[model samples]
Target: MVRRVMVDEEGVEMRVRINDMKEMVKEAVGNSGSSQESLEGLVKFILSR
Candidate 1:
């Protein structure tokens, strides 16, 4: 696992790391997520061209 730090320079600070695959997948499939929507748009544009 990789180590990371999340610092709220104006408030608080904490150590965190993204070690959850399921959480990542859930976010990647969210209804209006940028990554998913952008990918779909890209495919559609390619097909239309």
Candidate 2:
């Protein structure tokens, strides 16, 4: 299934992007940045999916 989802390098890149965005949100929350709102929005989005 993993192989099927990641058929090419572009798929790998997209996965990396998602991971990076998740990490950024974690850092923002830890540093008490204004990203809190955005992070919450992201969480809601993921949950809605």
Candidate 3:
């Protein structure tokens, strides 16, 4: 399972890794993207887990 926690960043800022994953998914859904299959595999893994 994914564990998410909030941490004080000295007022700098913070972000979730899922945002990066979504960006990767967007690229995968693009034309002829190499990550297209990878995105599917990741989704399966997450669901199975």
Off by over 4 Å in 3: 1-15, 35-49
Q: 16-45, model 3: which lDDT tens digit per residue? A: 566677788788788667777777778999
**Collision pairs in model 2:** none
RMSD of each: 7.1, 9.7, 10.2
lDDT, candidate 2, equals 0.81
- Each prediction's TM-score against the native? 0.41, 0.46, 0.36
- Residues 1-49 of candidate 1: C-alpha lDDT, one tens digit per residue: 1232333542223222234655677788887776789899999999999
lDDT of model 2 at position 42:
89
Worst ten in a row by lDDT for model 2: 29-38
Clash pairs for candidate 3: none
Model 3 alpha-carbon miss at residue 28, Å:
1.0
Ranked by TM-score from best down, the candidates are 2, 1, 3
Off by over 4 Å in 1: 1-31
